[model samples]
Target: MSQQPAPRQGPIRRIAGDWHVIPGWLPVPDLGVLPVNAFLLAGPEPMLVDTGLAALSDAFVAALAARIDPADLRYIWLSHTDADHIGNLDRILDLAPNARVVTNFLGAGKMQLLGKGDPARLHLLQPGEVFEVGGHRLHQVRPPYYDAPETMGFFDPVDRAYFAADAFGALLPAEAASVDEIAAETLRDGLVGWSSVDAPWLAHMDQPTLGRMLSGLERLAPEHLLSGHLPDARGLAPLTSVIRHAYARGTTDAVPPETIRQIETLLTRS
Candidate 1:
């Protein structure tokens, strides 16, 4: 069952030049609350990074309208076929008749399988392809970790903002307007904890390979790191450092003893 909380109507906060974000929170079982965010690029040709949660459909659409007229939206950038990310897609499409659904072939196919998205309105992007909307050049970036194979992130050269679909997400003890408000240790634990849940295979990944992937993002030198499940962040070093050390110990196929014990206890009780 979904652990998403009631939609919190929030103001659109500017993260970088012309890049605005609508941030909300979702409860993570036993871990705290995780941010559920969607970005808006206000420019000559406006675009939305991801549609917010279905639970907040009205508020999400209203938030977007507050930033820009729905009729003026030029693109709905689908990060993936994830429900949280695309919950209000059809609603937004109805509002923005001129907007096209920007996604990759796999993403389009998944939407087709789900029988939701309109094929005729899709603007399919090839791997490594850039989507130029007005003054901003959005380069497709696959994050180091993600829950979906078809997940697509983006790097905006104009603003030096990297929209990581689900990477760098964390669970915090409380709702934060910005990542800067989170304590260093809290952020570290949250980042690692959320990664453990969202990307369990991370425990089995080769450290060197993972390090290389993390390094690549470092090279991007993004001024702002935008994560779907993270509050607006201007720094990437802290987040990367946490990931680096957390997985430094290397891969393990065995489940944690604590988890096994809990499962056994539950079975016995039942």
Candidate 2:
């Protein structure tokens, strides 16, 4: 008898226009699970925020190819240097040879090597920097982090959109494309385990610092929040409440270890 086929592995949503969210889960080996949500901030040339792992590169490439020229992919920005976020660099480079890699001062030099330091395309970003590319302009603020020296988030002045990288976020990948209520419910359900009184990795975050970060995110009041991993495009006050509480109380709610581990296992092939 033939074996049952595996379930399809791919993105969850395909929204249209200047703002689009392509949500997908990316797996990693050894480290843990990570959700990579590839985005296109459309301008003269759309910006590819973070490339999913090499394993999922084709899905992202194909998605963009259908809407825009794969060659027109002009900017590939790094929120941080964590492997899950940066795993698919080689494959992305292969598809968009002209795309410039952007990141803040801390990882700028390293990103140069990662992007092969193509002088014409490699850009080193400074904290509190302003840049215009592909007809879109953005202001940036690089926050000091536990790992990366200058990991920052970008604010699109025109659109009121904030790309917050890994800061001020939550994961609801499976429920995207559904109504805001459904997505918010899914996000809440997933985080219960981590937000439980006894969360292991919740220890990683420093509550005071996280609170400050949350405050910054509120001040921005972005119409859309484009996170680095696993897009939750649907908007809601409750979801924001969870994220705020998580930071304020230093709760883990399982995303750091469990979800990250599961994603890594599925995305990585032995």
True-structure lDDT of candidate 2: 0.56
TM-score per candidate, chains pooled: 0.90, 0.72
Compared with the true structure, model 2 gives a TM-score of 0.72
Clashing pairs in 2: 27-263, 27-264, 28-264, 32-260, 33-260, 33-261, 33-264, 194-253, 194-254, 195-253
- Write down the RMSD of candidate 1 (Cα, Å): 5.2
User: After superposing candidate 1, which stretches have Cα over 4 Å from the reference?
Assistant: 1-5, 250-270
The TM-score that candidate 1 achieves is 0.90
The alpha-carbon deviation from the true structure for residue 133 of candidate 2, after best TM-score superposition, in angstroms, is 2.2
State model 1's lDDT: 0.81
Ten residues in a row with the worst lDDT in model 2? 4-13
lDDT of 1 by residue, 1-270 (tens): 864344465778888899999886665434457688889999899999888777778888888888899899999999988777887889899999999999988999999997867899999999999889979889888899998899998888889999998899886888898888989998877787667756777878887898999999989999999999888888688888888888776423223546434422321220
| lDDT over C-alpha atoms for residue 164 of model 1 | 92
